[model samples]
Target: MKWFEIALVVLTLGSGLVLLLDKLFLAKRRATKGGLLDSEEPALVDYSRAFFPVLAVVLVLRSFIAEPYKIPSSSMMPNLLIGDFILVNKFAYGIRLPITNTKVIPTGEPRRGDVVVFQFPGHPDMPGDPQRGENFIKRVIGLPGDRIGFHGDTLSINGQPLAYEVKGEYVGKGRGAEMNGATLLSEALPGRTHTVLEYLGRANPAGQGDWQVPQGQYLVMGDNRDNSDDGRFWGFLPEQNLRGKAFLIWLNCSGWFCKDGFEPSRIGSGIQ
Candidate 1:
């Protein structure tokens, strides 16, 4: 579901909770009192007293503090695997209203190497779009003025190669399938570090269009380089499209080894 839809659902649930609490607690007191029991009065007052305040609190916290998201793909692979439930710092990019998603505070811009969650630019109606019904999580590889290119599977930003080192193989889990001929490597992005996959002997088109990231826009890519359909295919992410910077991996729900169990190692770990 979209973020707005989820926020609506949450608001509705909170409203319901408040009404239930009022009926169970306050209605009996009013009934025992000498006041005439107006049938509609209890429901109206209960709902009004309960819903708005709770809803407002949640809206403020989620909009300005932090919001949670689940990783649904291997596009971030070694850094963030499928089923990783993470928290995003909403105020990192700026404060935006929950349902409307309009920024109200100018906190900061997305820096290079920051892992970001963004609204997918891929056309939702396109038949072959992998981003359909999904929010994409990727690392910011290139910024507004950076010239980005890839040759022989090596990423170059502003005519300089980002640091890369070979890590071990990534064993696939459950439906966490790997590409037929892909190898995982540890990649370093300026000050941030993560992992990327390289598809050797794969005939991938090199030297994509020279993107001059327009002002208030950023270029993003998956850490799992070869497997990601990122800014390379879809257009750049506008500043308004940014949700937040992903910071923590709170849970991994892959049904690989434990169908209903949690991965202890991933819990409470920070996202790079």
Candidate 2:
């Protein structure tokens, strides 16, 4: 359980307890004695009763329905930029226990081409991060029992090359303008399509060779093929480590290098 989630649980439980105690010992007594006006009630007690329900609702929504995340890297490139504030649909996967993230209900499964956020399974050679379960966003490329490979820039799944239509150079804006000259390609998966950036000068590209994906795990790669540190570097992601599916970009703000701050054109944009 993350510290922040634990804190929310504690706060909710504490406030609920206070409210329950007040209802049983004070509110009921006042009700029988012709009721007490708002000003007459103990300030702390009244506040607890008023705020506990609000806190509980917020906790439930944030923990299980949807959660917001800020994009911190250009790994997703044309699809998701740095400073894009996104909303992840937690229930799209399943209902899980708060903090622990233990799945209790099976809602759905991830499909090829779906964009997802999950805990970054650290590389063995690298030191473990303080936030070991830090999240990352990437496209689902390989599923359990699937064979995935890449020859140069072309991706092959089960020995069949995934189709790509060149979309010419992508002129990046805001925080990712440095990638303005990169090649853009519309990659087609079985059920969906998304644009990907192919930065020049490959440094250990992930889709170079064939790999057999294991059971109960997934192989993911970033849209910015040459730049992301993803499944290729840290191995497959256990299904249990998934956070949620990122489905929307609610807001985009100036990050690093924007001439005029907010990217209103990108607002309310559905994440492909």
Candidate 3:
């Protein structure tokens, strides 16, 4: 969560400042002619010393190495189900500062067919925007400057249609049962092939169109074609909004409480 990251950074920095201040001035006052003060160390200083290292390590790992995120919707279904806890490679794209999301190092760029998490481009900075700063995951369909088009449940990139092999109807379970009857097909993209769900005879007028992707942007869509609110509904995803590439499913459990919905088979599977 954004708030979680912010709070972690604040706590780590605050504790570090306290430690620095103590080492510079407070520690001298605590020392006496007998080599130590009669009173014990302040509770605040003790807490700062105890928690600073743990907080600092967590902040560095979560912000630069990898971060865990839970699936909250069925948009990327069949591949990423609701309740799946995935680990996103924070440095997969680049090294970005926490909270500000400013890129400090150029590591790599997203390839077509990569499952990426990004900030929702729903006017996130505008006040009163409910979806502000929200994270959304989808598959990259078109790279910058690529000619992308979608019509009749088919995707075309650079004037060539992506090959699709029907894999039959998808029988979803748990919270994804509603998508059970959706048509399943294995779509072949460059460097990878993944399954996609399409509803025959269903129309998505707003999402069906052709466009030329601009530079520093990407065209993305969900595997659940008919149901996803993705680049088709919005526009090209800004490069600055890119969070990271989701590569693994670490855990999966349905519902708010950890009740009877655990999909063990999906655990440790890499996202294709």
**Candidates ranked by lDDT, best first?**
3, 2, 1
Local lDDT at 138 for model 3: 98
**Which ranges of candidate 3 are over 4 A from the true structure?**
32-39, 123-128
Question: Which regions of candidate 2 fall more than 4 Å away from where they truly are?
Answer: 1-3, 25-43, 200-207, 255-260
**Better model by lDDT, 1 or 3?**
3
RMSD of each candidate relative to the true structure: 5.1, 2.9, 2.0
Model 1 agreement with the true structure over 23-64: per-residue lDDT tens digits: 797667767775545565566565656577766666667667
Best by lDDT: 3
lDDT of candidates 1 onward, in order: 0.74, 0.84, 0.90
List, residue by residue over 1-272, the lDDT tens digit for candidate 2: 36677888888888898878877887888888888886788787877778889889988998899988888888898889888999999988888888778899999999998899887767767776554677788999999999988777788888889898989998876677868888999998878888888854464644467789999999999998877887777778889988899999998985455543568889999999
Better of 1 and 2 by TM-score: 2
Candidate 2 lands at a TM-score of 0.88
Error of 2 at 115 (Å): 0.7
For each candidate, what TM-score against the reference? 0.78, 0.88, 0.95
Q: Which lDDT tens digits does candidate 3 get at residues 1-272?
A: 88998999999999999999989988876674334542467878889999999999999999999999999999998888998999999999999999999999999999999999998878433557678578999999999999998999789999999899999989977777879989998999878899988897786887799989999999999999998988887778999999999999999998767574788888999998
